[model samples]
Target: MLKVFLVEDEYIIRESIKKTINWAAEGFSLVGEAGDGERAYPMILKSEPDIVITDIRMPFMDGLELARLIRVKLPQSRVIILSGHDEFDYAREAIQIGVTEYLLKPISGATLLTAIHGVAQKIRADQSRIDYRAIYEKEHAEKLQLERTDFFKNLVDGKLSMSQVLEQGQHFGMDLSAVWYQVMLFQVRGRDLAEAVRPEAAEADRQALEIEDTIMDLVAVQGHAEMYEQIGDTLCFLLMAQTREELQQTETSLIAKMKKAAEGSDKLLYFIGIGQAVSRLHEIKMAYQSASRAFSARFFSDCSGIFRDTDAGFLPESDQTELDLSRLNMDKLDRRIVYNFLAGGTVTDVPDFVRNYLTGLGRDNLNSLLLRQYVILDSIFAMAAFLKKQGISAAQLEQFQNQFRNFNANLTLDQAETRLCQCFDNALALRDSQSQQQYGRLIEQAKGYIDTHYACEDISLSTVAASVHFSPNHFSSIFGQQTGLSFIEYLTQVRMAKARELLYCTKLKSAEIAFQVGYRDPHYFCYVFKKTHNLTPMEFRSQRGAKAAVTGGTDACG
Candidate 1:
């Protein structure tokens, strides 16, 4: 119901108007009444009514002044002028004050009722448009975020040339031009969801997501870095600065924020790998590769902290020519280190893991042919055993051994490390390929569910994940990895696709189409339609019709 406030000097007129209409029955609520504008202003401000009906020529705080104040403070409220005099000046001033209705006094209550009804309908329509725009803006923002994610992935992946990167950066509103640039990979290492119990794993995933969100928020607040969410529970940030020193400072500040974000959560461990600062866009690939190598340090160290390009390698303290075997740390040669690394490492970890493993065996000891051969056989058998535990057949293990049959003590430490990296890389590749098959099936199931239920308004990440019997966070990780889009982005894609088909092939109005394809607000639906296709529904339909007419095919539905 619309709230109505009244101000008239004559009590008799006010009572008569109030008595004439039963406010409740007329769909109006007569909230307050005053004898004059001075008395009415405060009451009107308090009630914040939708309609203000006032007598124009009052003693102080006249109708014009009240209307002006309302126009400034409560612009949404409509005003009606009641005047005893039929003067041109009063009507003109009322119009100037933006009054909804300028009624000469001695008016009946029926005239006032008609004016109020019109204002109410206008307010409802205005509110609907406001709501529509809000929804449209939200969806547009989400779509832009996903597009930015893809752009960042391509930017660091070296799939785009320098010119292409700059052009695409411009399109996405990212200023890629910088004097110095660096890439940082922020990773969340928590409980292994596959090995962890269900409830505990889900809780940890939730906490990890919250921590990541906090770090992302911090990065956004800094304004110099651009952060993108990646698959595998990682955040990729591109930090830009005017000079190398400034870039170093930016990296330091961001790492502090990240560490603070991880402070309270024991279950949520994090590592940040910052690459070297470079001066060109194309060099971002080199920076990212170095950052990734640094990131893989966590596999060997199993510690939560920041790593840098210098931390990526495992070099001996001195040249092997001056190395002392007497000072060798036999503890580093423990076979469990290699076994543990193999059990929980990725292909990216192979190089650093191999270097660290070989260095631990004593660089000087690697010169003794017997010890060197023992080390090689130990690593080879470790890989064989790891692959076997993963269910590689005896025949497959033999095939794996065939690749290394030429291995001997003739290899230098560098050569031995290189060969070991290759072996670990192959084993991890096989393991990942098997894991990918399972992930592929889960993703397909989730996508199928989303396709089937895209028209349901309640469809969401949680709902789709539940359908596939996975936790929401875990599903989110794999969904992005497999599809390159978040759950919300994928759902919007499905809804928009359906909306497009309806707009092109059917005679339904946009609102009806919105309802049929999961949007509750028709105006919002139209807004997203325009944003996605650069044309409103009607415009798209007309464009399609024009094309069909040119081609001598059936015209699209009007």
Candidate 2:
């Protein structure tokens, strides 16, 4: 109900007006009545009445003053002036003070009711606008958040062609078309130590953000940069440089900045991988793939610190070198050698081993795989040299180099069988060490938390971190690095997964399931669910002959 305040000096007039006006019927309440404007100021300020009915020529602080104060303090309030005189000057001054209407004294109920209704309508209209603006802001914020997740997911999935993804990104409010982009991948270690030492997950997240911001700031001083996503605990950045030279300079500067950021931070070590430049959107995914592969080189610790696929030296040589094995048509022979060695058998003569083993295989059997391994082994030694230059233990590199040499020197027919088997065992062990199950345990913990709490409306990175005793910032970085899924995407996936469960298990209404799964609005839940799952809740349930069940199955209505 709208509240109205009265300020008139005459006692009889004030009481009569108050009693005669059917305020309840007109959707207003006469919250206060004062003998004069001076007496009414405090009451009006306290009640904050939506409409004030006051006499113009009262004792001190008349209607004009009251209206002016209300305009300043409570601008949404409407004032209606009641005056004994209908003088042009009084009416003109009342309008100047933003009085909505001037009612002559001895006011009739019908006329007063009309004025109150008009002000009430204006209030309702104003309220609608406020409500709309609030909804718009909320939806806009959510859209931006989702777009960030979608962009990164698409890049990783290789589902949409890069050009199509970039085009769609524009619709989602990202402008990448005219930007010069280079991708950087970060490989993070020391997750266990970081969590053990820093109890606050939010603080860890803040530190990560600070690191990213610092890197971006340093890059910005030279050129523009935009962080694409934090994949797993690693941060991926797409930098825009003015020229090839600038890109190289920026990469060098970023590497230095990141090393500094990681230094002295307990349990944090950084390995950065940079990709070749790509001018067109269609080629961006290729660049990202290159960077991703470079980042993975941390597992080998024997490749270039920065691997650019565009570098001719990094590419496989087309011409067959003496060591190429391309012309040897040795696929069957190589596999046999590797298998025998892995099975604990051996070859005796080096050159004789190759020629005799491959004698029966067709020339067409030759492929790039054998040649590539040869190139990679060569690069591994080169990487060991680079690491030594950077102050790494020479013994470590020398150990690996010796192994490579042993495998090369034993190229005789008999030893080839043994060396290939040894190489197979070593490669398998390396791959096993980098498996998702081995390195992704912490990420699984975070994901488990998400699966459990995604139904809470307030579920977020902060809440998840709190549950695990991590700062939100640290959790975000670590979780991303471990799972390659950002916090929001992971959460959304959890929600959608639960929605699927509900759709299959019971007969709860779609709206109820939406609320049960932490989405307050059923319409929005349906929209997001369909976007993720390609079917509305009901449609999905229908197709599977499954029904959404309530928590207890006591009330489908819920």
Candidate 3:
């Protein structure tokens, strides 16, 4: 309720006001009343009323002076002045003194009530804005949650530079210049294929998060761990320990506690790949990578156990006689099978394609289980990154995860293979539902827009993406994927292609050609043209009659 104070020099007028208005019904409390400004000042100050009504002409201090004093002492209070003065100077001075309402002396109760109601509405609005700010701040704080797995993933994946990482880490007061840290990667298997098709995948992602919460909650009590989520069905955690023994003890505690937590849960099963401890903060990424690689161990699918990369027996003796394959043994899979699957192949044998890929990977390490898991997770990340840039989002990735069943203590090899295949089928179904045409059309439209507008100096990725009704980021990804070129590359290609035609066919100077091709800075344009075509405008024009060397490939397409 608003607290209101009344100060009037006229005794009859003050009593009439006090008696006529029902302050309670108006949502105001009549805390105090005064006859003169000087006498009322201290009382109103003591009462701390939200609103004050006073006469401009008084015995001691006038209303303006009282208001000026109140403005300093209680700035939030609203002041109303009732004065008979018709002088322009009077109203001006009241307004300057911050009076909210001013009325002539012969004022009606209804007129005063109107002013009060207006002030009340304004006060409510101001209060509501204040409350909204408070609520916004709270929600913003919630966005800074400790479990920002995506941020950590980016950090480990080398997406952020050291300075960027440090600057972001500073917002949360994290000092990354630590002596020792370990990365924990957990690969979880969810319930059968039928159960994981939920809206949020709250059930599948839960397996990793559950172990994460259990370990982090306990370790947080001791201030020893920080964790973040990464791509795929994995969560990465960094633990800080001063001593090797403490690190070992912490890992042992985490393993034991997490195992106990998942004892009866039939919906989920998980195992952690613990990376070797590293001394430098920058080396933490290496630790994470090692942990990520460790998740591929084929021999260790025991019930929610912890395995460290530093363990002597963790990796079998290397045979190293075969070809040094690519990231996560992609070389193991037959190119045709992998390409067929990736090219939106038939769903009937999609699992076989995946299983064939898994079976093909070996590097003297006999741990087929670990190798298979590694390849699968790595393939998801790789394929997602690859497909996302083209616009066919890895929308099926999560759905694939739902159907994917990796090895677990409770599952046999045949059961694992069956589930893995089921996962692929599920993935194919989701992929089919979202055909390439969704973002494909957008990319085509974007390219056409760029082609039409390339000569405009202001043409940019954001503008082109906007023309196609997609975000710059999404447009960039899809544009890159569809054309096998980035937005900038494609845009530059179009400009250069036009510039080449202009250079070869017309007599325009380098600068004019540059301008016509959307290259505002001629020297910069020369640099880019040289970079793209290995020839300056003059050189390219000179070579127009020579064997059209750079004109046959994507160089000509651009």
Winner by TM-score: 1
Q: List candidate 1 segments past 4 Å from native.
A: 1-49, 53-60, 84-86, 106-110, 191-195, 311-349, 360-558
Error of 3 at 113 (Å): 5.4
Q: What is the per-residue lDDT of model 1 for residues 1-558, given as tens digits with 9 covering 90 to 100? A: 889998988888889989998899989899999987888888988999999988887787888998999999899999988888888988888888899888876788788788778888787778778776765575566566666777888888889998888898888877888899999988775634223334666677667767876887788688668888765567788999998789989988988898888877767667888887788888998888878777766554544778887853444544454436686677666555665566556676677667766666666666565666667777778778777776677887898888887776588766777777888887777667666776898899888998899998777677887786654545766787799887777888999988888878898998899999998777777877887899999999889888897998874343
Candidate 2 displacement at residue 266 in angstroms: 3.7
lDDT of 3 by residue, 1-558 (tens): 899999998899999998888899988899999999899999998999989999999989989999999999999899999999988999999899889998897988988988988887777767756654653454344345422444675677667777877777777656565657788766455542223345544545545455555655665564566655442334566777878888777777766665676556666666677888887667777887677555544122324456666433322445453344443454444333333344333463354344444444543432344544554555455444434433454545554443343435344334545655655555455555454575677677777888889888667666776685443434554565578875666777888888888886777899898889886557667877898888877888777645455664333324
Residue 492 CA displacement from its true place in model 1, Å: 5.5
10 residues in a row with least lDDT, candidate 3: 296-305
Q: Each candidate's TM vs. the true structure?
A: 0.71, 0.46, 0.39
Best candidate, lDDT = 1
Is 1 or 2 the stronger prediction by TM-score?
1
- In candidate 2, stretches whose alpha carbon ends up further than 4 angstroms from where it belongs are 1-125, 155-166, 186-223, 230-234, 241-273, 297-558
Q: Arrange candidates by TM-score, descending.
A: 1, 2, 3
Q: lDDT by residue for model 2 over 414-511, one digit each (tens)? A: 34434544543443343333334533665777778877778886676667776765545446656666767767777778888788878766779999
Candidate 3 lDDT score at position 65: 95
Output the TM-score of candidate 2: 0.46
